[model samples]
Structures are given as structure tokens and as C-alpha cells.
Target: MSSLILGIESSCDETGVALVRLPDGGAVPQLLSHALHSQIDMHRAYGGVVPELASRDHIRRVLPLTEHVLKESGTTLQDVDVVAFTRGPGLAGALLVGAGVACALGAALDRPVLGVHHLEGHLLSPFLSEDPPEFPFIALLVSGGHTQLMRVDGVGDYAILGETIDDAAGEAFDKSAKLMGLPYPGGPELSRLAEGGDPEAFKLPRPLLHSGDLDFSFAGLKTAVLTQAKKLGDDLEARKADLAASTQAAIVDVLVRKTLTALKDTGMRRVVVAGGVGANKLLRAQLNAACAKRQIRVHYPELHLCTDNGAMIAMAAAMRLQAGREQAEKTYAFDVKPRWPLDSLK
Candidate 1:
């Protein structure tokens, strides 16, 4: 058997391809090569991803990206033992592009295929880092569309601690940024602007900060940001940085506190953060500082892997196969799940 896993990810605005070599015997898999194409610039003018355009771009990017990954890995399609792709909780059209291509390739190569859950890929992404996390850690999954706390015991063993009831942490960031007239992908832009201003410059609500449970709600926070911007009125532009700082502070505060509450409740001493928002420096710094005070180890995906990427998908698949949590299928007929829950993989 080739023991090479090929992963494709087109769940949203990014197209990614990667190759991972599952180690002989029972060692962990190693990432070989991966390539990604971001559609952020393309969607900037529109303020968000357009589903049809994203699907078309995935078609144009996946194959060439796959070729690049194979070439960089010193391998070819013939060496692939399994093909994996993000199968859901995303735009249906975009999901189809990756699922269709992955299935077609699997059929052509006579290799089995596995449909990896998108969030599961994110949750397991830290394993690709140099300081990979051990099993049985608490996970905080914060991204553009989702915010969740999970207890991961093993490859397919996950228990969601709590999830967002309304707006997620990322959504809170983006919407707050939009109110400040930041760029389309507003979260990072807002975070950047926030650096120059005092986080206490404006008072923002930390929604659900004391709700007494892990459930998150950021919708009210976004409303507070909008109100603050309107109050600034003609001076909004000059004071935008302050607003950004305050917004980020509110979101980060809620996330950090809730995460700590989860840790306290579970009595676990280690936490792993994954997904796009995991790349935010403020969140990372706060989490690190907080965890340090409690002697809890905090792990994160490599900065590059913090976003949707091929390496995590491939690594997740390899781990699943290694643990016998799932079996690769030779069947080529496949479908995408635009709303699959991460814990459903169990």
C-alpha cells in the first residue's frame, strides 16, 4: 500500500491540496507538501464570498494545486493510498467542487476515499504543529462561522461543551469591523487597527460573559458596536480604532473567560485552539497568559494552518485511519453536507 493520503479542501473561499505520508507501524503521519489558493482578494469588492464564484474558483484551483503538492512531495497520483476532502458545513456549491473532484480522482486512481468533516479537520489541526497536543485536551474552535468548545478524548471521541446560540466570536469581529468601515474580511483588519488604540477607550458589552454556562452569544456585542459607531457619528472614522479595540476586547474577554470556565468545570489542564480566529494575536496572548496563570498548557495550530488548509484535512484523515475510527471506501459516489456537526463524526 502507498500509505499516502491526499487531502482537498474547498469548503469556503479557499482551495487547498496536500499530501501526508502515514508512518510505518504506529507512528504519527507526517505532512509532506501542501498548497493553497485564497479567494479573499476576489471577494473583497463584494464584502463576502459569493457561493457560485467560490465554486468556480475551486474548480480552477484544486487540480493545479494538487499537481503542485504532488510535485513538491516527490510523488504522483499513483502513490496515493487514500483521498480525503471536506464534505460539509459550508456552501453547498463550494463543498461540491471539492467532493466531486476528490471522488473523481479516487475513482480514477482506484484508491479509496474518505469524506472528512470540516470542523473535525479544524479540531485535529494542532497535531500538525511541531508541539502537537496530546489526546484528551479541551478544544476551542473559533472561526468565521463557528464558535465551539469541545472535549476531544480521541480521534472520533468528541463532546461539545457549548456552542454559539447566535453570532459567533468571528462574526462579532467581522460585523463590528464592517460598522467601522474596515475591509471585507474585517476580522483581521479590525484586529490590526485595534493595536493602535486603548482597549478600554470605549465600553463594549461582553455578552454572556457571566451566563454561568459555556454557551456563547455575541449578537448583542455586535449591536453594541453598531450603537457605539452611530454615537461617534461624524467622528466615527477618527475614532474607529478605539471602537475596534473595544470590540476585540469584548470578544476576547468572553472567549477567554468562557474557555476558563470550561477548563475549571472539566478539571483539564491543557487546551488547544484551532480555526481561523485562532490566528488572532490578541486571543492567543490572552489565552496564553490566562492558561499560564493556571499552569494549563495551551496548543495552537501553526499560524498558516490556523485557516482552512489541506495539511489539517490530510492529518485528520490519517489519524482517523490510524485509530480505526473510519474506513476508506472504494465507492466514488459522494455527497457534501453543508451543515454537518463536528460531534456527529462520533
Candidate 2:
């Protein structure tokens, strides 16, 4: 009595479609196949996301990608038992594209539809990895617009330990990269440029390094990067790599120290890092070294699954249904939550 679940994710600039098989027995759901299309190239020209363009692109990509996934999986739309989609905390127009498509598909097939929280998809993404984690681990979620530490006991059981007060770690990287005149989607570019530079060449601020709490603040770090760039007016180009490295170092230092603090406070040796920033090589290297020193276990989403993807959405929906935490409804009526809070998913 296995069921095929179709998932769609269009919360932002990426259009992702995936199919997952939910087992009737007590076992993990298996990913059948997935397809993704990133609007990075298009957004690059604009230097950032354009909401209307994003929504339009999502509309064009979702169906084709869904077809691609089904073909790769050797499945048909008629075989799908449920349709799942990202419903909130994203661009309003972009979200509607996914929700509308998912609900319409569900209605046409006379199947149930489930709307998943975007962050929950990220939180549960690592389950798709070869080495999945056990329950009750500390989760460090970092991305372009988010940074938080959470205590995850199980599906739908999450407690926020700390979160960003202003900018997130990803913003620190991207903004700093921009200040250095790097291209759009600056974080990865900055990381690459940093490879040849001395991380200690420039002194950058580690905001809230000792806030006595788990909360984070990276807004000031962005300002510091701007100040440094201006100070190097004539030599900025030659020293850009060093600045990038320094900025990355400062951000990583704060993230690692705060994560360690959270680990110590919770006495949990296992940690899960999710979201786009989880793909950062330096962060992974530093975190690995730090965790190994403490003899702690760290789990991550497969590299391909680190970013926003429909696979995570499908897996999350399947798990939620299996856990009996939520139900797919026949009513296809839907709305998007562009500002939904993760903790509020409580």
C-alpha cells in the first residue's frame, strides 16, 4: 500500500518538482525522482530577484519540470495519490504559482493536496541523504535570509533556541561580496574569491559574539565590510579577495561559536545543518573540525538537496502524513504566507 506523492516548490527563484514513494510499512519514504530549474542567471542581470519575473518563470517551469520528474521516475500523473507544495514564507506571486499548480493538479486527479511550510522542508531535507539522522538533534538553519538554532525532537516538534535579530549569515556573505564588487548571488562568488586570500588580512566584526544568548546579529558586519571597502578606495580591487576571506571568517566564527554554545547548552552531541548556506565548503570544513573535536555527530542534506528543492517538500509531506501529524484535504482552496514564521508553524 505505497503511495506516490508529487511535490512542487516555487517559493523563490527556483522551480523544483519531485516524486516520492511513501511506504505502507514503518520505513523511510524513497525519492523516486526530481527536477529543478534555477533562475539565477536571470536574476543575476537584475542583481537580485524580481518577484514578478520569478512568478512568471515559475509558471512556465513547474509543469514541464513535473513532467520531467514523472518521466524520470517512470510514473504518470494518474499514479499520484497526493500533491504537495510550498505554501508560505516566500514571494507572494511566486508561491501562488506553486500552490495553484499543485492544487489544480490535485483537483484534476481527484486526489488530496497538502501545503507544506518552506522551512519544514529544509529542516527535514537531510532525511534524503544516504546517512539520515536520528531524532532530538540541534538544527542550525542558515540561508540568504534566515539563521536560527532549533531543537528538533521529531516531525513537527521544534523549538527555536535562537534566531537572527537583523541580517542572516548568508546576507553577511552576499552583502560583503557586493561591497567588494562581486557578481550577484555573491555568497558563493565571495567564497571562491576567498580561497586565494588571507583570512586574517582584514579585521572584521563578529556581531553579537558574546550576547549571552543564542540570538544572532549580522547587520553590523555588513556595515563593517562597507567601511573597509571605502577605506581601501584605490586598493579595493587588489585587496578584494582578502576582504572576502575576512568577511567569511568573521561570519563563520560567529556561527561556529554560537552553534557550539547551543550544543553545550543543550548537551546534544548530534547536530543537523540545513538551508542554502549549508553548502558552503569552508563552513562545512570548519564545522566538521569543530564537531569532531567534541566527538559530536553532524548531518547535512546531500549537496544537491542543500538548496530549495521539491524533493524536500515531498519528503516532508510524506513524513507528516505517515506520522499522522497532518492530513491532505480534498479542498483545493489555498493562500500563500509570504511572511510565515517558522516557530509559528508550531
Candidate 3:
């Protein structure tokens, strides 16, 4: 018999739900339906996400989104055999909304429930793509709150090779963009502006590039952007595109070099890039070129899957369920880990 799983993700500003069907003895999983609600407009005025607002918005959207997924999948809630949700490493209030909804639904249905790690969901997202990487690959997770490299030996077996000591790569992009007067969630906006600008126009430091460790640091890079912006004076907007281009180039340079180094250090021929920054065109291009030169394979989630979404959460839950991973007990009530470490989970 086939098993259907309902997955909910509210790790950040996005509320996502996906229904995945696991077939009997199948090598690949099937994606039934998925829905995502972005809170970009809600948080745009504030220049970034506010946890309380994000949590409230999630509560309002999750159920409807779940309904949409079920309807689109042509499956009723009663047919769902398992419930999955993102448990931690995100906003405490946000995680609670997902956890509460998932647990409640699971209990009402008398089904098992699993709490997934947000980063793990990102790491496994590539598997949902057409060309999935083989086992024992390296993963570079670069998002708003994190930047890390890991060695994935198998399902649920993740080894942290290196990570950021300061602000994450995505944070750097957003911060730099803000310094250039870009709006909230400036990372993508910054990348767009970078298209017409000369990447070499500004000389920005690649923080910790020579640290000799896989660990990264972008706080200094952000400072460099700030300094440059201040020097540009009142006409900062006129040079905004160029500034964006230069900043992005600096960041991509460091990320590409470090990822290549990690691949070489671990002797892993396959690499998977995840998180919001994974969508950066420059980073993707550079990584592709670098990996091609070394005959190393690179994997990425579909563009839509690159960001925080429910499909990754659902897919990850399916894998854990198949592996017989422990389930959250009915009485097990927990909150989010605002600072959960991926290594700690491992």
C-alpha cells in the first residue's frame, strides 16, 4: 500500500504545504501537490521579517494551504497517513504555529508525526530535482540565517565540515543591499541591480578567505559595503547597480572558492547548493564552471525549491518516515530552537 504524507513548513516568512505520495518499494518518491504563501508584501514595509507577524500570518495561511494541497492532489485529509512539520532552527513563534497545526492534525487523524530540521530540509531539496546527486556529496547551505558546508553520507547522516562564524551569506547580501538603499529582502533585488554594473567597479574584501578553514565570515564584507556606500555620498542611488554588482561578485568569489576547496578537501565529486542564496545567478554560474573544470558534479533544487518551501519539508519527512526515525509522541510538546545547530542534531 502507498502512504501519503502532509508536510507543513513555517520556518520563516513563507508558509508552505505539500502532499507527497510514497509508493510501495519504489526507488523514487512522487510529488502530489504543493502550495506556498509568501509574506513578502506584509514584511516589505518593515525592511525584513518580524517574527510575531510572520507567526500570525502562518497560522492564517497553513490550514488553507493544506486544504489546497489536498484538493489538488485529489486526496482527502483522511487519506493522509502521516503529518510532518518543521520543528526548529527558526523563529520560536513561527515554529510553534507549524508544530501546533501538524500535531493537532496528526492526533485528530490518529497518524504519526515527524518534526523535520529546517536545514536538513534544505540539504535534501536537491533530491527532489530531476538529476539527484549520488550519496556522499558535499552541501553548501547559504541562507538568511546560516552558511555551512556539510558532507552527506546518506539519509539523515550529515557531517558539518565548516560554517560561518558571523553573519550568513544571505544576510550579507541583504545587509549590503540595504546599505545601497534597496528595500526589504534586498538579496534578490540586489542581484537584479547587479546585472548592468561592473563587477570590478569596487574593491571589496573577501572576509576570511585566507583563514585556511572552511568556516566563513561576512560581517566584514558588510562593513566594507557600508564604507563604500558612505563614500559614494548623495548620489549613492546612481551607483546602486554597480555597487550591487561589485558586492555580489565579492560574495560569489568567496563562496565559489570555499565550496571548491571543501569539495577538494573531502574528495566529494558531487556538490549540492541549497538555501536562498542558491538562487543567485552569478553563484550558480561560477560554481557550475568551477565544478565542470574539476569534473565534479553540482546539484541544485529546482528554482522554486531553492527557497524555504513545504515540498522540501514533505520530501524530507518521507525519507525519515521510511527510515523508521523516531516520531514526536502525542505528549511531546516542544518549541523552536532559534539557534539550533545542525551539527548538534547530527
Candidate number achieving the greatest lDDT relative to the actual structure: 2
- TM-score of each model, paired residue for residue: 0.99, 0.99, 0.97
Give the C-alpha lDDT of model 3: 0.89
lDDT of 2 at 334: 91
lDDT at position 234, candidate 3: 85
lDDT of 1 by residue, 105-191 (tens): 999999999999889999989999899989899999999899999998999999999999999889988988998899989999999
Candidate 3, residue 313: Cα displacement in angstroms equals 0.8
Candidate ordering by lDDT (highest first): 2, 1, 3
RMSD of each: 0.8, 0.7, 1.3
Give the Cα error of residue 255 in candidate 2, in Å.
0.8
After superposition, candidate 3 runs with Cα above 4 Å error: 327-334
Q: lDDT, candidate 1, residue 277?
A: 93
Question: How displaced is residue 51 in candidate 3, in Å?
Answer: 1.3
Error of 2 at 227 (Å): 0.5
Task: Kindly list the per-residue Cα lDDT of model 2 for residues 257-285, writing each as its tens digit.
Answer: 99999999999989999999999988899
- Candidate 3 lDDT, 1-346, residue by residue in tens: 8888888999889999999887778466678999999999999999999999999999999999999999998889999988889987898899999999998898888888888899988998898899987888999999988999998887778888889899999999999989888898899999999999999999999987888989999999999999999999987888888889999999999999999999988888999999999999999999999999999999999999998999999888887766555554554465666667776653
In candidate 1 the C-alpha lDDT for residue 192 amounts to 95
